[model samples]
Target chain A: MNMRCTKARRYLSQAMDEQLPPAVTRQLDEHLDACRECRDFREDLALGRRLLGATEPSLSGNFDWRLQLKLNQALQKAAGETAYPWLEEKPRGRGWAGNFTTAAAFGLAAVLALAMFIGPQGRVMPDDAGRYAGFETSRQVAGGVSDRLPLNRGALAPLSAPRGIQRSVSGSFGLGDFSPNAAFVLDSGWSGNHLKDLATIQELKLRNQRLNNQLYQYQQQISILRRQLDRPDSNGLDLGR
Target chain B: MNPSRDEHRHGSPSAARFDLVETRDEDLIVMVQDGNRKAFDELAARYKNRLFSFILRMVKEPVLAEELTQETLIRVYIHAGKYREIAKFSTWVFTIATNLVRNKMRQRSRRPQLLSLNPAPADDEIPLDPADPVADPSEEIQRRELALVINEATAAIPEKYRIPFLLREVEQLSYEEIQQVTGLKLGTVRSRINRARNRFRQLIKPLLKDETLLAELEMIEARVAEQKDNPS
Candidate 1:
C-alpha cells in the first residue's frame, strides 16, 4: 500500500471498532486480508495496548481506609439527625406508626364513649367531671394540642351524658371547659345530641379495629418468616443408615 | 454479562469459583444495606483505585481526586438506605462519580480565566540514566518522542470523548457499563472510544517510523495471520 493508502487503511481499521454491524466487520476483515500495510497498522495497535497494560491503576496506599472512614462518618451523621425515618427502611407500606395512631384514636374514643351516652338527658347532676377530665386528657394524648378540638356536637352527646343527671351536669359545663377559644365553644344545644356521638365513636372504633388487625397480620407474617429461617435443617435428619 | 441466562452445560467447579470471585454487585448492595461495614469497605476497596485513577486523570489533581473519591463513597453510604437492588452496584457508584466529575468540570468551566489544563508532567517524567546513556540517541529519542506524543493526544481529546475513551481503554469497563456511567447511549460510547483510539493511533504513527519496532509489530501480525491460517 502507498503511504497515504496505508494511513487511510489504518483509519478504516480503527473505525471498525465502532462499526460492528456484521456487514461492516466483514468488509473491514476483507480489506485487512488484502492490505499488508493495514495489517501492520493493526499490529501496532495491539502492541500499543500490550505495552499500556503495565500502566493499570494501582490503589493509593490509604484509599480504602480513607473512603471507608468518610462513608462511615456520613452515614453516622445521617443516622444521628432526624430525617424521615420512613425513608431509611425500604418502602413497604404504611407502617406500625400509622396503625398505632388509628388505634390510639379509637382508645380515645372508647374512653370518651361514656360522654356521649350521658350528655343529653337533662337530669342535672354533678358527677360528669371525671368523664370530662378523662376525655380531655385522652384527646390531648392522642392528638396534639391544637387551636381546634375536633368537636362533633352530635357525636358528643351520647358520650358526654349517659343519664339525665349527667346530661345536666355536663350541660352546666356545656363544652366550655373543652374549648380554649370561647366564641367557638360548643353550646348547651350540642349537649343534647346523643345518637351522633355514638355514631362517631363507633366509626372511629371500626377504623381502629381494622388497622389493629392489619398490624397484627404483618407482625404474624414477619414472625413466621423469622421462625422458619431460625429452625435448623438438621442436615436432612442424619441417621446411621 | 448475562451469566444467569446461560445454560450451565460446560463450566465446572473452577468456573463457578471464578464467577464467585467476580462478585455480583447486587450482593454487595444488599450487604451494605444490611449495615455490614466490612462489606461496604470491601466494595469501596474494589473500585477505589480505578475510580481514583479516572478522577486523577480527568481533574489532573491528586488532592482533588482524593476528595472526589471520598465524596463518591459518602454518596454511596448516605444513599445505602435508598439503594434499589435493580442495578449493578458498580454502575450506581460510577454514576455518582460521573456526576461529581461533571459537576467539577462545570464549576471549572464557569471560571473566566483559562486555568492550566493538565498537571505538570515533570513530576512523573523519568530522567535518563547517566550510568549507561544511549550512545546513538535516535532510538532513545524515538521512545521519549512517542511517549510525549501519546500524552498530548490523550490530553487533547475533548471531554465528551475522553471519558468514554478512558473508561473503556484504561478502566476496561464494557461498553454497556460505560454507557451507564456516562448516561450516554451505547452507540455514542462506542463511537467515542473508537474516535479516541483512532486519534491516538494517528498521533503515534509519525514516531513509529522506527524500523525496528515497526518490523517487530509486522512479525507479530504475520505470526497471528499464520496461526489463523493453520487452526489447532
Candidate 2:
C-alpha cells in the first residue's frame, strides 16, 4: 500500500481518541506533515470535537436547580396520582349503598305523595265524575265567552266585564277583570235577611265558582299528566306543583 | 482474531457490572414505584446534573431542556414497571431523552403556525445564561462562537449520524457501549462516527481560521493534561 494513501485514510479519524492503533497513529502524523489540506481538515475536526466537548453547559445555575425542583415535583405527582391498587382489587360496595339509599328515599317520598293526593279523601267519588263533567261544561263556556269577547284573550279566560262594554273597547285593554280572584271578591263579603237570602244565593253561587276554579286547575294538571304519560319514555318524571 | 468463549468470558465482567448498575436503576425505579420520597431524592441527586446536561444539549434551549429532563424522570417513576432490563439503564434513559427532544422539535414545528395568532417573542428575549462563568474572556467568546457554528453544522448531519455523534462526541460514550446503547452494527457505528467526524470538519472549516483551530486544540490538550494531573 502507498504510504501517502494509507496516511490520508488514517487522518480521517484522529483527534484524541486513545483507542486508535499505533500504525494508524503513525500514518496520521505523516499525512499531517506532508499535506496542508489534510492538516487543515484535521484541525477543523479537532476544533469541532473540542467545542462540542465543552458545550455540555455546566447547568449549575438556576436552570439546573429548576430541573431538580421539577424532578421532585414529578416524583410527587406520580406518587399522588397513582391509582389505588385496592380500588381495582376490592369491590366498591359504598357506591351500591349510596344508590340504595337514594332509591329508597325517592320511593318513600313518592309513596307519601301518593298517600296525600290519592288516598282516602283523595280518592275519586261519583261526585268527582259529576264535577269533572261540570268542569268540561265550564271550560267550553269560558272558551266560547273569550272567543265572543275579543280576539286577543286566552281561550280558558273567565268573563267579568259587561258584554256591551267589552265590545266597544279596543287596543290592549287588559283581561285583568276576567280573573277568578276579581270575580270572587265581588261575591264574598255582602249581607241582610233579604240580603241573607241574597247572601245564601251569593254563597251558593260562590261555592260553584270555587268548585269551577278547583276543577279547572285539576283538569289542567290532568292534561299535563296525560301528555307526559303519552310519552313513550317519561322515565318516571314528577311534575311537582 | 475470531471471537471465542475466553474473550466473551473476559467481556462478561463489565457486562455483569453493567447488569449490576442496571439493577440499581431498577431499584431506584422500584423505590419510586413504592412511593419512597427519599429514594427519589437519592435518584435525583445521582442523575439530575447528568440528565439535565444531556437534555439541554439535545433540545438546545435551557427552559425546554429543563422541562424534558423533569418529564423524563417523572416518566421513569410512573413507568418503573415497564422498564425491562433488556438494555443498560443509561442507554434507556438517554433513549427517553432523545425521544423527548425529537418530540419537542416536532411540537415546535407544529406550534409556529398556531403561534402566528400570538405575538412572537424576540430572539434575545429568550434567555440562555450559560451556568459556568469562563475564567478567560477570549475562551468564552470562542466557545460561544464555536457553539453557534457547531449547532448549525449539526443540523445538516442525518439524525442517525447525529444521535451517535451527540452520544459519543458530546456524551463520550464508547464504541462498543454505544453499539449496545443504539443497537447498531459495530461496523456501522464505527463508519458513522468516522463520517460524522468528516462532516463536522467540513462544517466547521468556514468558522475556524487555521491558527485559531490550532490554539483551540492546544487548549484542549492543556485542559486534558491539567485534569489528569489534578484527577479530582
Candidate 3:
C-alpha cells in the first residue's frame, strides 16, 4: 500500500470508534473510497473489534463471593489502620526507652500544671538556697508584688533535658508542635486563652495577698499575748511564762 | 455535562433525592469518594466483567486475572478519595489496572516460567461467546474456531502492541484514553495500535481460508461497509 493508505489506515480504527475529528473522517472516507487495500484494512480492524469484543468472559463461578471476602478483609484492615499521620509505624519502636520518654513527657506536663496552680500562692516549700524556709516579709513589702506571677522560669526550664524531643513527642501525639510553653500548658498555654488565664492567676495572687495579711496580724497578736504572759504585774500569777 | 447531573455529582443536597443507580459513573465515584461503600459496590458491579475480561486476556490466566481484578476494585475503594474528576472514571480505573498488570508482568519477566507441565484446563480457556450460544450446530463449530483463531492471534502480539490494541478494540477506549491508560505518547499509541492491528489481521485472516467461515466473515464485512456508506 502507498503512504497515504498507510496513514489513512492508522486512523481507520479511530474512525470506527468515532474518535477522529470530522475532517480526518472525511479524509479517511475519501482515501478508503479510492483505495481497496485501505478499505480491506479498515474491514480488518472492525472484524478484530467484533471478534475480540466477543471474547470478554463472564465472571463465572464464585468470583463475586471471593471478591466480597477479600474486600471485607481489606476494609477491616483499612479501618484498623491508624488515622493519625506518623513519621513511623512504631514511633522509634516501643520498649523501655520509649516508655520512659512517654513517662517523662507526661511528668513534665504535670509539673507545669502544678506550677500554674501554686505559683501565685506565694508560699514556697523550698528556697533557691536549697533550704526549707518561709518568707518573713513586712506587710509594707507585700503591697509591692506584681499583679501577674513571675515568669515560670524554673518550672518551665529544661524538663526531660531535651527540649527538641519534647516538641516532637507532643507532635506525634497530635498535641501540636507549637511553642514549648503551649506544648505542655495545653488549653491554658499563653498562645491560647491567655487573657482568661491571666485573669485567673491575677485574682488568686490578690486573694493570697489578703490571706497573708491576716496571717501576719494573727501572728502579731499571739506574740503580744506571749509577752503579756511573760510580764511581771502587781497581782500577776505567772501563767506558764 | 447536564446541569442536573452536575447537582448530583457535586454532592449537593439534591443528590440524596436520586437513587445512586440513576447517577453517572463520575457522580457515583464522587459518592465513593465521600466514603459511600454502596456507591463503590455499584461501580464494582458495573465494571467487574470488563475489568476481569481485560485482565484475563492480558494475563492469559483466569485465577491471576480474578486476583488482579479484585485488587483493582479494592484499590478503587481504598484510594477513592485521591481520584479527582479530571478524567473519566473508566480512564482512572484502567490506569490503575494497567499499573498492576505492568508490575506483575515485570516480576513475571524476571523469573519466567518456561511452561506449564499440566494440560491447560478446559474451564479456563478462551471461551466461546455465551451470548451467541445454542445456535446452528455447524455455526457453533465455526464460531468456536473463529474465537480460537482470534485469541491466538491476539495472544501472539507483543505486549506493547497487544495492550493498546485490546484497549482500543475490546475495551473500545478512545485514542487519548488509550494514551492515558498506557502512559504512551499519542503518537506511540497510534503507531502501536496500527502495528498490532496489522499483525492481528495478518495472523488471523490467513488462517480462516477454509470454505465455511470465509463466506460468513465476508458477508459481515460487507454489511459493515454498507452500514457505513448508507447512514440512516
Q: Quick one: best lDDT, which candidate?
A: 3
Q: What is the lDDT of residue A91 in candidate 3?
A: 58
Task: Give the per-residue lDDT of model 3 (tens digit) for A23-141.
Answer: 78887778888899887777766766666754445575566667778889987555334322222256555889889989999999878766753564344444564432321221112
Q: What tens digits encode model 2's per-residue C-alpha lDDT throughout A1-241?
A: 2357444644466335555778877766776677787766665677787766655454444544555566667654443333222223344576978789889999998777555434332232224223322212221222232111222223212133223322221112122356545444332221112454466556656555555556656765764564444333444447575
Model 3 C-alpha lDDT versus the unseen true structure: 0.66
> Model 3 Cα displacement at B121 (Å)?
11
Give lDDT tens digits, candidate 1, residues A50-71: 4333233334455555666676
Q: How well does chain A score by TM in each candidate?
A: 0.31, 0.28, 0.35
Indicate the worst ten consecutive residues by lDDT in candidate 3 chain B.
B1-10
Indicate the worst ten consecutive residues by lDDT in candidate 1 chain A: A165-174
Per-candidate TM equals 0.50, 0.49, 0.57
Candidates by TM-score, descending order: 3, 1, 2
| Model 2: CA > 4 A from native | A1-11, A14-40, A72-241, B1-54, B84-86, B109-142, B210-232
* Candidate 3 residue A8 C-alpha distance from true site, Å: 4.2
- Chain B TM-score list for all models: 0.63, 0.65, 0.75
